[model samples]
Target: MSSVPQPPRWDVHRLPRARGRNFLVTGGNAGIGYFVAEQLAGTGATVVLGSRDRAKAEAAIGSIGSRVPGARVKHMPLDLADLDSLKASVDALGLDRLDAVVLNAGVALDRPPRRATGDGHELMFGTNHLGHFALTNHLAPLLTATPGSRIVTTGSFAAKSERLDLDDLQSTHDYRPKRAYARSKLAQMLFALELDRRLRAAGSTTLSVLVHPGGALDSLTPSRPPLHVRTTGERLSRLPLGLLVQGKDAAAWPAVQAVLDPSVHGGRMLSPRAFGLRGAPRIEPLWSHLADTTTAARLWTASRDLTGHDPTFTAPARSGGTEGPAAGPGEADASTG
Candidate 1:
């Protein structure tokens, strides 16, 4: 009998060349998102860091340049808390064909006195889930136009124990900082899976992949200077924890793999290999809660209504212009956030 062949093991240190390809990472100015942008930049891809802070974005760009000589990276202003601004932000990307987008930006509030977004939705849920939802819909044209494009949604390990109350997605009735943040991430994960299902149904080429950083600690992470710095003592102190939890850099592997790995299919989830914590990234089975299609579909509907943007997977007809499609209204100023 023939043995089943295993897929090639992914090496986080070595990545495939993606010259001329364009990719975006939301919140790439810091944390796991920053590492994701840096890794992609090493692949010779044009990496855009979606951030709301120009100063932080520039600093991150400089940090990547310092580490990876000749790195191609820039920042696009993005405010996930402002739903009305998402469409304009997508337009500012100025790329004719977008290869992939990493939905990784989020706001995790730990203190009391629950806050809301500009649109009046809970801060975590609105910015983390709904904002990405609207942004994806707005970028649908570019994604579908580019063959084999992907949307990689970064979820969280905290989401494992939390369940979403679809009726109160905004956490209006019951509000807890950690619980709200976890549910928001759960919603984002569910959206990624449901999106793949919808894409398949529509016969679209764009793929939606989900991923989560297991346990990322700044103390365990290597420094990138201006963006992030770890002292020798800090590293030594966190060395023991490295056995279980990893740094943000390692946490970025799964998302990067989802973007560049040809074998990675839509609707799949990737995570750390060692008990879903501090090892290299590997494919993981979707949690039982994430497999509930009924919940996902309902959440999708609610998202569409709240964002007022329906994602259509259809690709637009290719135009003759070499620079890609012309910018839509309010897209003329790429520098404006």
Candidate 2:
């Protein structure tokens, strides 16, 4: 008889408590983000729901509170597609002591090429990579204050399918949705690994991890075709169908693990159990080929330069634009925001 297979041992619900810690979950209003925030708040952590919509953030906070009384969830406006908005939000609510940060707000802006976040970069790179890049850098002081702080950024299996185009990141020469998304994810890997190098070189112990959710419940999974095509595909996929992993909850698993897992080391990678696609979460090895020292260093330099930050490696970004405020009688600082 075929043995009953066991599932991966990780379940975010079974994770340890996060009491006394603070977290920021962007796009926390819905989908996997909702679960991530809910879980964090449920564990007694102070969570700030970052979103572009004030009303939506408020609703997310209410949802968290209703689900877990006195969950201590707060709302702040954060638009990943707009650096100005993120800068303002950081100034308004980004604290001096951040224990963890989740850079989850992303879009499949594969519809068309466009400038995003800030600095007139392409939409995919700007929103998926640069925006979070700025946010994390701006909040460096707060993160470092926590001593073993973790920075969690999302990656996708699409990296395997798409190659990097360093010369024209905006795809001015050759722009495809898949290529844009993959390059950004590749940047995510390079960014995380380089950060680890920088932290270790400076003798710092903070963890910067990258997690890919396989197929998860994310849009990365192509929707099935019509009934006839789907049926045939399903039958053919039987040899591998069981290995497919898909779902936001599943994707969130690896991310949650990377940040919360005590056993995880800096720069480590975690992914689903399926054949590079979807399932329960666990600590997997880094896609080691991504351990490109030259590439990592180069990407870091490019990112900092492109994002309007300085020192090519360390130091906070110089506020490039005129500062503004969220409401009456206040002005946001672009430098650290």
Candidate 3:
């Protein structure tokens, strides 16, 4: 393990053992999120599925139970579009430590001029970047205290089209759904790298890694009861697009690799090799602009201002439990029920 173990391509069936660990996968009820949760659970990890709909979460949990006998899976209500829900969910998640958190929930937008969140930010940006920012900040303490923990953010190839306007992060002045999505993704990529830098500087054990599933389509994935409702459209659509993209299970491979690959380190990005659209997972180069430090700092400040949650690198002391420093800049004390 001195050098990053280059597996014979990214294969979930070959993932390292993950027993006695806990993971939280946002949007784990469907799509690649669900498969990521499933793959991790198959390896004996306790997985918490975070979804906006409780019914969807429960359905996902049930599906996991049936797919992998004795899978340790649970559901928690989480709505990334609403910061209040984010706060409440964190308070309710009473875990002292989490091995990894995969930020996978987001609005996959295809139309423009959509609705905004309660916070008044653009929907995609709010849900994709801002909400995750708050959640990670709040959970920083638990992650920092957990040895060799990681945060894997789900990124996208759409980010290549982003033209960042730091002043107009929400794209309030001119809004197009695709560009809005791209901008949010660019922001996420920057934040991931920046967060890694900060975590290392703070001497925390936690690491931040970003991974993307390139052009994955739902049509090719296996159906889960009530959740993966296989539609005629999916079957028909797969005829043409099936060869062009990988399925959800295949797409989840990179994230799974990032989670268990001992060779992977913080600030690295894992993505598909075939034009970033379909193939085995690999570490690929990204747009230089997306990793600009100055922009990352600006986005970090804006995120703090918008969400009011900050990562202080340490958690407050807990009696009869793990303890660390008190809340300081950008950090919060334990939730006061």
Candidate 4:
């Protein structure tokens, strides 16, 4: 084929402004992070950029403001690798209520031994999975108050690397950089679906969804992959897969669509259009097993325990897999990676 194709579309651009909406987007300093925040702020929403580096966040915010002059954009400190930082972040941004929260911050590590966070959990699992787990739990109260609130998170097509491992969430038993990364992402996907399920069961119709950029990044989490696999991922894009490598700019499309599209429902998984690689925005489903209510509940329970916070506070009991309200001041925050 001369060029790769994109995903199915359904006239999504007509969506109106996000006026009066307040959002918290992690890693909104640059890359897809900035794109997501920029799109939202451009549409007239108040966006709080959550990042580890205050300096970096400030720069990113400045750029966003410049792009969307007078855009309601602000910055807050959020270090997914450190639990203490997570708490400080909550205290800083835990407002009266929040309209949306997107978990987009992550690291791509080089082929290296597994690391741990300040809380002593595996770094990837700690930062990528646990960090958001606590943040979401803490902010549930705000979500419940807002009728159409959303929590959007980014996953990876590589999420299939391994199945959910309740037994080895920390990867203390076996650790391959790719496998561990996949596990963490899988954990994130499960959390997204499970939170959605819990909300529906509780008679709450708020939105919680998952998204991935496909094989969208030349660089991924800070932890590097094996040279061969990583190099292979980088190689195909420049050659045979050039058309499919829609670039990181397109990455924010799927996430932005998820955030903006009113038709999107809870439990949906979105990706870009470029074949097995990349494209525009389209709605897709996660692995069938990801929707399993049993696993969803277990994952939620385990996450609350791992993060040392109650995911659902007065959020009401959940049915399917989602439990807890969407917004509550977070407690017992933990790291992501």
Candidate 5:
């Protein structure tokens, strides 16, 4: 007789108290990012909501404050599609230390016309991979200074079905929306793995983790003003398929777990247990190709070349290190929203 399936060992819904800690969540204005921010703040962590639109950011902060009493939230305008905007926002934050950063912003729609960013790179690749690449490198020093800091890169199950063409990282010649998005997600996974290895090699305490929130429905997440407004159709549709497709709150569990769980270590991956669609977050083997070390290194090199940002950690001086924020050739700017 087949044995009954055991429940998840760790409770994904119930999070540990995180008072006095601080976190930054990209794309925190809506969907999974907003829910992740809420969850963190609900447990007493100060959350900074990063969004391109100030109104949306303030609205999200308000929503979080109303829902989670005593929630401390700040707004930092960030446009992931624009490098200069991201740098400016980071500078404005004036952060000396950060406990964790959740890189959750990206273009997920697999539509036609093959959009491109103002920087001339493919939209999906630029926003999902290069943008986060530059931002993380820019904040590496602050992250290194904070004990037990984590950099969680959000990936997707689609990475398993996508192929990365290192030669054409921008997808200049062959551009398909769905494939481009998949390749970008795959690049994110590779970057997370490589970053963990590099951080460890540098003897830094900061951890880099990879995670994916499988198939979450927007209908289930809170409706923020202006954006994330769930239409009647969406709410009605979710009524029948709620069990099959989990809400954004549940989907964000793995990312929040990656950040708060002390047991999670660098170079580890987390995702939903039930075939990546729904269930509690759990450690699982990466898709065979995404675990390729050689490819990860190559992606790292290519990212540095393209984004002009390096994550390599150097020893700080006894007095004060001279290493400053990374400065590279300016890329065209565009609104993430």
Candidate 6:
């Protein structure tokens, strides 16, 4: 009798070569985003760091170059808080094709009297959820144009427990900073799932996948000189914490895997395996709250209204896919909240 064959296990250190691909990572200048960019750069693909600060982006690029010789990486200015500039920012990429874009940039306020974006929406909600929503709308054409392209939205474990109050999606009624931040992330996660549904309905090849970094701590992260440097003492002290959590570099695995893994499919979510807290990336069931299509549809309508962009996406005609027109915000399913 033939022996049973086992599936190959994913190895984070060994990524498939992507010599001709193009990838964009928003907020790739620091933290988990920086590590994601660096790891992607190792695959011999061109990586663009979408950042607001030129200086910081340059530092990140330099650090990646230092770590990975001949790394092809550059910067594109993106201010997610400024809704007006996102389209122009996308236009600036000037790429003929984009293989994947990691929507990882975000704003998290630890303590606040509460703040609003330039467009007057709550800061966290506007930048984290709405900003990516609008950016995806603008990039829809390019994404659909590229064969087998992906839009990877990096959500947060912090969102697991929160519920969306559709009446006040921006946290106008109740504004604790941490809770508001979690809500914003929850909105992003919901949007990813809904987008996947719409894309599948339209027969598009472009995929939208979701991921969350488990608990990541700066103290556990390795040093990337000129960008981030973890002192020896800090590493020694945080070593024990690594048993429960992980460093920012390790936290980046789920998003990276989503971008590169062939088996990953749209609408599926990847998270850490160790109690959703720390371990290698693995496919996980969507949380019950995330499965609420009603909430997602309503949030989609609100996002369209707030951003003035309808994200009804479709594949290019050449791809043997039909195009769909943008739906009116009020035209959301009657069954939706």
The TM-score, computed over Cα atoms with residue i paired to residue i, of candidate 6 is: 0.92
Distance (Å) between predicted and true CA of 160, model 4?
A: 2.4
**Model 5 misplaced regions, further than 4 Å:** 1-9, 222-240, 314-337
The model with the greater lDDT, 5 or 6, is 6
* Residues 1-337 of candidate 6: C-alpha lDDT, one tens digit per residue: 9989754566777777676678999999999999999998887778999999999999999999987878999999999999899999999999877889999999999997889999999999999999999999888888877767889999999999999999998888879999999999999999999999999999988899999999999999889987888999999988998999999998999998898777789999999999888999999999999999999999999999999998766756673664321221112122100
- Residue 232 of model 1 has an lDDT of 98
**Superposed model 6: Cα runs more than 4 Å off:** 1-7, 319-337
Provide the overall lDDT of each model, using Cα atoms, as 2-decimal numbers. Answer: 0.88, 0.67, 0.80, 0.72, 0.81, 0.88
Provide TM-scores for the models.
0.92, 0.78, 0.87, 0.81, 0.87, 0.92
- Worst 10-residue lDDT window for candidate 1 reads 328-337
Considering lDDT, which of the candidate structures 1 and 3 is the better prediction for this target?
1
lDDT, candidate 2, 1-337, per-residue tens: 7999753444555656666678888777766676678777766678888887787677677766766766889887876667656566777885766777877777775556454545577777888777787787767767765666778877778886555667786667677777788888777777777887787776654678877767644343222221012244544555354456564555677777776666677777777877656766666766655867887787778888787763212322336653221111111211100
Better of 1 and 5 by TM-score: 1
Candidate 4's residue-wise lDDT over 201-308, tens digit each? 777756888998776554432112121123555555466545556545557777777776666788898887655357767777567777677877888888777778
Count clashing pairs, candidate 3: 0
Q: What does candidate 1's lDDT look like per residue over 249-284, in tens digits?
A: 999989998988778899999999999997888889
Task: List RMSD in Å for every model shown.
Answer: 6.3, 11.0, 7.3, 9.6, 8.6, 8.2
lDDT of 3 by residue, 1-337 (tens): 4987543433556555566678899989888999999988877678999988888888889988888777989887888888877767876888877888999988868886577999887899999999899889777867876767889999888887766897888888888888888889888888898898898887776779999899887777777767776677787878677667888888998888787666688998999878888877889886688668888888889888988877667422345865422211112211110
Candidate 4 off by > 4 Å:
1-15, 218-240, 313-337
Native-to-model Cα distance after best TM-score fit, residue 316 in candidate 6, in Å: 3.0
Residue 47, model 2, lDDT: 86
